[model samples]
Structures are given as structure tokens and as C-alpha cells.
Target: MKKRSIIGLTMGGLMLIAALCTKAVTPTLRLSDTRPKIILGTAIPTKFGDWQEDASQVAAVVNPTTVAELNKIYAETLSRTYVNRQGNRIMLSIAYGTDQRDNLSVHFPEGCYGGQGFAVGQTSQVVLPTVAGGIATSRTVATLNSRVEPITYWVVVGDKAVPNSWEVKKVKLAYALQGMIPDATLMRVSSIGEDIEQGYQLQQSFIDQLLQSMPPDLRGHFSGTSH
Candidate 1:
């Protein structure tokens, strides 16, 4: 065969294989449908352990996502303030989307805070205590005016709790390559306080208590553990 003709044939074959692979791996099944319906209202308890949801402070907690973004990104978003007997309050926000395709995933707190004129600090890795030992997470501090907020959050890609944004994308792509679209959730817990260390400790304790209050399976669901 002529060299030009051979090169052209090779290119054509490669393009055909690429198209076939793309079609073969196109995700048509949502992993969420394989499980029971998710109802944020009941999936996360209103009152757990010594903490109870306080309606008054719920409004005080601001969601990082705006109304339009919230509607676009999440199928259900839950935001609440829980107060303990000691009057300590922690604001919990959860964003869950049944479909997390390549074009969309979840919003970052740093972006929202930056847009709102708040100074966001460097994020540090942390582990949230759970029955399965500990789940990897991230923490950062955001400040606006005199208010200081310390946040501890994690992103779950399907049944896996990813360590960072890069891992999130990797997991999503793996699922997509398997012809499955994975559901994802972003859970954030924060408290307004100047003492960042103390704030993190309190948040950790709250998470431990909250997880302990749920069933083992539910605990696994929240932490993305096999427990």
C-alpha cells in the first residue's frame, strides 16, 4: 500500500475506535436509582443525641450556594442549625445531586465566600471521626468583617469519600467509564467563632455524636464507609 494511504487508513480506524468507545461507555444509569429514594428531611435527623434543631438560628446560617446555583446543582439541599443543651450552635449544610456528570459536581465554599467579600484561608486536611474509624475531609476558615467561621466539610463521590477535588473527578470518571452516573453529596459543618482550633474540635464532636445517633447503615451512607 502507498504510505499516504496507509496513514489515512490508520487515522480512520483510530477515529472509529474512539467513537465506539465513547458510545460504549456513555453513562445511562444513575447509581442513585439502585438505592432507596433519598429524602434529606429524614435521612438526617432533626434531633440527634443532645443536640436539637433550632429554628431560630437556622435563618442565621447562610448557605454558600445562592438560590439559582442551589437549584441548578442539588436535587435537595438541607441547611439547619443545631443547638446543644449548653446553647452551643453548629450550622450544618448538605447538598446532594442525583446526577453528577462531568459538566457539574458541587460548589466550593471558597468561591462563594470570595464572591461575598469574605477572606478564605488555606484549606487543611482533616479526618472526621466515624464508626469506620475516620473519614478524610477538609477544613478552612472564612472571615467577613468581625465574624469568623470555621468549616469542616467532605465530598462523597458515589460510595467513596474522596480526599480532594482531583480525587472527586477521578472517581466520577471511573464511574462514567463503567457506564454509571454516580450521585454526589457535599456536607459542610461550621461554627462562627474566633478560636479556630476550638471550633474544629466542637465540629468534630458534633459529627461523632450525629453519626453515633444513626443506624450503622445510615452511618456508612453519611461517611461513605462500608461499615
Candidate 2:
């Protein structure tokens, strides 16, 4: 029999916990503030454990762009990509803020769930404390036995800027969604090959969404590709 693998994701080093035990902090959104806590479109090295640098590095690039463009990219990518170790192969980001509720519900469903468990206590690298004063975050990681693979996630609550280029941004967003798959299911070549295809789709969608959502001033900056 093929080795059954536990899909796992380590989000910046944070762990998933039971929703009931978890606190829901109301996110504060301000239309006026568009500036990012960190410089937009800059490379952010991996701060978490051994898990690959694909997602975090990706976000560091695109989070600063407009939301409209980002969403466009997101929807497109998911259609093209497949969930796997490489990254999320989807393209949907609109549900991010709201999906926190959805994922929490999945994680702590009314009945018994196999991936219900979370990583043992939090690790320092897992948590990315708030910056810019307005941002707050809630994250979780889930493992899928045969269905989806395991993944780590970061649900940021705020009108804060995302880091990285468009490609990286898509990776981060996809990871947030597909991170639930088990690790072992992803090791297979078939799974990984599909993931790469999906990764590009996710990246394209992220780019489209960020471009669509960008404010006039920011959009100009992105078009020029200088800084």
C-alpha cells in the first residue's frame, strides 16, 4: 500500500487551533489608509521553519498592488492550478476575509473531522505580529487524509498592504486556501506536477486582482516597474 501521508503546512511558523478555543478579533478596515506596513513589492525572506519559501516570498511581491487586479488574478489561477505541495493552483481572493469564518467552521465542524487537530503549541516563526497598527491576523493549518493536502494559513484582518510581487502574492493566497491538504498526498509526482501548473494560474489571478484593485497612483507605479 502507498504510504498514507499527513499533509501539513507551517504558516510563518504559526499553528492551527480549535475555533472555540480561538478568539475572533474584529478586523478594523479603513478606506483612507493604503500605505503598507512594510515597503510594497519587496522581497521578504522566509521566517518560518523548513517549509518552502514559495508562499511568503510570493506575497511580498504583490500585496502592495490594487485589490481589483489581485482578485482577477486569483479567480483565473484556481481554475488553472491544482492543490499540491508547490502552492495553491486556484485564483480566488475575494473570500479571504470572509473565508476565515468558512475555514474555521471546517476546522471545527459540528461533528468529528480527521484534520481537526493542529500543530502542537505555536512556534516563534509561525506568528507574524501586527504591524501598521491597523492589521490583525488569525491563522490555521489543516491536514487532509485523501482529499486535499495539508497547508498553513494566515488570515490577516485589516486594510494593510500585502508584500511581494504578483506571482508571490498568488502563492500566498492559494496557500491560504489549499493548505489543508496532507503532506504525504503531495509528495507524489502527479500531485506536484499538477501543483506547478496551478501555481502559475494562481499567480496570474493574483496579478489580475492586484492590478484591478490598484488605486490610480499605485497602478502607475506598477505599470512603470521601477519602485
Candidate 3:
């Protein structure tokens, strides 16, 4: 009976020590209260350069399952179609998550498009030069039947633009270690056309002009730079 009692005491003491160590290592952190000050709809201008919002058509380009998933993950989402004077139309989608953790990260267009029955093809990394600095972006061409859509998209994790999943995880872990729950946004611009090169060029031009027209303070939020 004494031996059994000593074993029980030793196990309890070890469990207590483990619990104390966990408490010491785990960060005592919470998301900042003043985050996500810039609203997506108001920050992005309605009319920039020759591009204007197309009010006639309402195409979100997201499937029902993805939409449902997004509703749970993101705090806000904006989907709009913009047309230029030369009849070039681009679909713009932005999703913002207040808490960008592993389970609640922003969804990329490549996977989302694949989920929506679109065949994703030929993905490449591209650098888009904004007024602040050069932001790394991903370009992918998605095809569905006769429609070919060229997409340019990027994800902003914390204050930096991450190009791939590996970078995203690194950024998130860095923030986590600093006791911060970083916010993230996924910005995507796509156009349906035959020439993928021209489509990407136009999208870049659109992004440049749009960034130029935005407020100086708010530009960093989208461009992932303080400058």
C-alpha cells in the first residue's frame, strides 16, 4: 500500500511539473483591438483610371461550398467586376480575416477555382511594382470550357506579401511567436481572354492605377508595405 501511494504521488508531481512548463512556454496573447482599420469597399476606389465598376453584372465567381466556407473564415469579403474604357473586364475579389491562424487562413484562388469546376493551369510567380514597393504575386490561368481566365493574386500576411504556402506558414509562425495573431487578406484580379500575357499585363496596369488612386495611408494595407 505504501509503494502504490508513493507511485501515485510521484506521477501527480510529474504531471504538475509538465503543466507548469506548458504554462510557462505558452504565450499569453490575443489579437489587437485596433486591427483592420481600413475597410475593403471604401479603401478601393469605385473608379480608378479608365476602369469603372460594372453595376450591370453581379458575378462573385465562387461556388456555394467555397462561399459557405469563406463565410466562416473571413470577417469581410468584397467581389466586384470592373470594366475599362476599351471593353476589358476584370473580376476583383478580396477576402479579409481578422485572425489569420492555421485553421482560418485566407483561401487561394488556385484551390478555390479548382473547387468551382475550373481547370487550373500554368501557375507562375510575378512581381507587381506598386507605389510603395514591389509586391510578389501569383498568376494562374483557369479554364472552363470555352472561357479562359487569367488570374493575378497575392496574399498579405501581417505587413508582408507572401507568395506561397511555405512563406505564409513562416510569417504566421513568426507572428505567433511574437504573441500576435496577424490579420491577412487575399486579393485576386482576373480577366477572361485568349492571350494570357495581355491579360496579365492589363491586370498589372489595373492594379498599379488602382493603388495610385488610393489614399496614401491605406495603400500599405493592400500593397503589404509601409512606404
Best by TM-score: 1
Assess every candidate by TM-score: 0.92, 0.22, 0.85
Model 3 C-alpha lDDT per residue in residues 50-152, reported as the tens digit of each score: 9999977546455324668878888788888899988988888888887876788888888888888899997789788877689999988999999999999
Full-model lDDT for every candidate: 0.86, 0.26, 0.81
- Tell me the spans in candidate 3 whose CA falls farther than 4 Å from its real position: 1-32, 63-65
TM-score (C-alpha) between model 3 and the true structure: 0.85
RMSD of each: 1.9, 19.8, 3.9
Best by lDDT: 1
* Cα lDDT tens digits for candidate 1, 125-190: 877776556888999999999999999888888888876788898988899888999998888899
What is residue 133's positional error in candidate 3, in angstroms?
1.6
Which residue pairs in candidate 1 collide?
A: none
Poorest 10 consecutive residues by lDDT, candidate 3: 25-34
